[model samples]
Structure formats: C-alpha cells, structure tokens
Target: MTVERTLHHFPLDPASRQVRLALGEKRVAFHEVAERYWERRPELTRLNPSGMTPVLVETDGGKTLVVCESRAILEHLEEVTPEPELMGRDLAERAETRRLLQWFDRKFDYEVNGLLLHEKMEKRLLGLGAPDPANMRAGREALRAHLGYVEKLLTERDWLNGRRLSLADFAAAANFSVIDYFGDVPWTDFPAARTWYTKIKSRPCFRPLLTDRWPGLAPVAHYDDLDF
Candidate 1:
C-alpha cells in the first residue's frame, strides 16, 4: 500500500526542523503545509489539541494516522521506515542517542533557545517588540557553554552519540541551525563544533533547511555556506 504523508510545520521551528531532517535523511517523501502555529488555526488544533507545528498525517488508502509533535513523528517514521535506522542499532548507542535527544530538546532549548530564539525570532514573529539585550547576552553565554560540551563530545567520538550518525546529530543540528539563522552562534569560538556542523550542513538531508526563509528574518551570509 502507498502511504500519503503530509507534514504540517513551521519553517523556522526547531522541533519542526528535527522531523524534517529525519524524514529527509530517511528518504521519505511527504507534502508540506507551512503553518503559523501561534494563531492556532482551527484545522491545526483539530489535528492536535495543543496546536503545535510538526504534525505528521499519513494516509494509507482509507486508513489515516495522525502523529503529533516532533518526537512522536520521528519515532513513527523510524518504525515504518526502518532501513535508515536513525535511532541506533545497539542498546548503548540507542541509550546515548535518546539521552542527547533529551539534552537538546529540553536543556539546550530552555537555556539557549528560551532566551535567544524567544527574543530574536519569536518576539519578531509575534510583533512583540525588540529583542531583549540582557536575555540575548545570557543566551549567547549559554550557547558557548553548550558548544564547548559539543566540542568535548566530538573530541572522543565521530558523531554525537557514537561512531555512527544518529538522531542525536540531527537533534543538535536542528537547534543550532535555527540559532545560526540569526547569526548569533559563536562559531569561531568553537572550531570542533563548527567543523561538525559543516559536515552535517553538507549532507543531502540538510539542503531543504538551508533554503528555509521567513519574512523579515534573513539568514546570515554563512548560514547556508557549507565551508563556513
């Protein structure tokens, strides 16, 4: 049976970007519906009561499956399309992958994104006035700390989780990509993390994300540059 898949997501959303990277890496074809989740469109809310972006709707003939949120959508994709095996093959690898996923989704998000993204991107999108200077400073400091951790991890391993590329890499990349869009990432201060990002940025799965653009939010000149 052929499954018709549709992804309703916000282009600049980190969570949405994770799912997009996963789908692209897994080679799954799907239609996209760019949503303004803050407005809480009735159709979006009907699909997900929380009215979040990154909702996946898959229809196989008459049967339809609605997977809400990035985590759920990613897990669902892994189950249905297991060839690429993004989560991991072994227990240790899987555990590490899940751990890093949580780290990025929660810790990194709260510390870095909550300040930087909320001020730079969210405030602009919602017309909530200018970015807060104090918050931006704090966010930059936190980002450097996180990047230092990433640099340490890369020093001991090929990928974020282990030797092989996993969801952990995608998770971190997704978050950093959004931050890089605003030119806030201190790439020069972390050479290892920058090199790692360059590797992921050159991947075929990352192409779409490189082209992502929103009104009044222009990416840095090096945002899409693989060598930068």
Candidate 2:
C-alpha cells in the first residue's frame, strides 16, 4: 500500500523548511502545498486552529494522521523512521539535541528570524508596508552575536549538539537558509559557522530548499552555491 503525504508550507518560513528537511532526511515522499497562512485560509484554519503552517497530512492504508507544528512533525517522522537517527544515540545526546533544537526554534527565532525575516520576507509576502530599518539593524546585531556563539560551539564539536548530525543542525540550518535568502548572513566574518553550513548545504536533503523560489523575489546569488 502506498501512503500519501501532503505538507502545507510557506516558502520562506523557517519552521516549514525545517519540517521539509526532516521529511527529506527521512526519505519520505510528500506532496507540497504552498500556503498563504497569514491570509487565514479556511482549509488551513480547519486543520490547525492556530493557522500556522508546515502541517503534515498523511494517509496510510486505512488511517489518516494530521501533524501540526514543525517539532511535532519532526518527532513523528523520527518515531516512524528510526534509521539515520537525527535526535541522537542516547538519552544525554537526545537531551542536548532537544535543548539546542529549542534554542534555535525559539531563542534564535525570537532574536533573529522574528525581527529579520519579518522585515525581509513576511512583509513582502503579506503586502505589509516597508521593511523597518530599525528592526533590521537589531536583527543583524543579534545574528552576529548568535553566529559568534555558533562558531564557538563548533570549535568543540562536529555538529551543533555534539559529534553527530542531529535535528539541532537542521533547525539552525533552516533558519539560516531563510536569512541567507536575503543575503543577511555574514558568511565571510564567521568562517567556522560558514564551514559548518557549507557542509549542511552540500547534503542531498538540502537541495530542495536551495531550489525554492518566490514569484517576484529570488534567493541570494550564493544561496545555492555549494562551494560558497
């Protein structure tokens, strides 16, 4: 029996990107549905009252499952497909991965993506007014600080959580890809972080995101450059 999977996501949304990468890493085939979630589409609101995106709808032999929220979707995928374990190998490693995943999903989102992406991507898509220079400035500063911390962490381990590649790496990479789409990342200044991201970008699972395009807006020139 072939299971059908559909993912409702926004092009520039980091959370949506995260779930996409997770599904790809798990080698799961899914149909993509571009969503204007901010428009409060009836079908979306019906599925998730929060009206948020990255919703995964899966239909197996006789069962249908709806998974809302990026983290939940990732966990569900991991539970269903345990090979190439992304969370980690042991309890402690899993805990660290979860902690870093939350940090990227929450703290990083609040500090950087919340401010930078809103001004750069969200407003443009939503037809909101102009981008606020002030917020962009603040977000850039936060990004620098965050990048510095990431570099520091990479000095000690191969991946964000530890020696193994995990969800933490994907979470951070998803957010970074969104910011990078606008050429917001200071890749030259953060060599270590750049090296880390270069590796992530080279992965087969990351290819789909590199090809993502918005109607009028295009990704930065180096956004998909593996050598970059």
Please name the candidate that would achieve the greatest TM-score relative to the true structure: 1
lDDT of 2 by residue, 1-228 (tens): 888999999978899999988888888889999998989999998888899998999999889999999999999989887888999998988999999889998899999989999998888888898999999999999999999999999999999989899999999999999999999999899998999999999998999999999897888889889987
In model 2, the runs with Cα more than 4 Å from the true position are: none
Encode model 1's per-residue lDDT on 1-228: one tens digit a residue.
989999999999999999999999999999999999999999999999999988999999999999999889888888999979999889999999999999999999999999999999999889999999999999999999999999999999999998999999999999999999999898898888988999999999999999999989999999888887
- Cα-lDDT of candidate 1: 0.94
- C-alpha lDDT (0 to 100) for residue 81 of candidate 2: 79
- Displacement of residue 160 (Cα, Å) in model 1 is 0.3
Models, CA RMSD each: 0.7, 1.0
lDDT for each candidate structure: 0.94, 0.92
Q: Count the backbone clashes (under 3 Å) in each candidate.
A: 0, 0
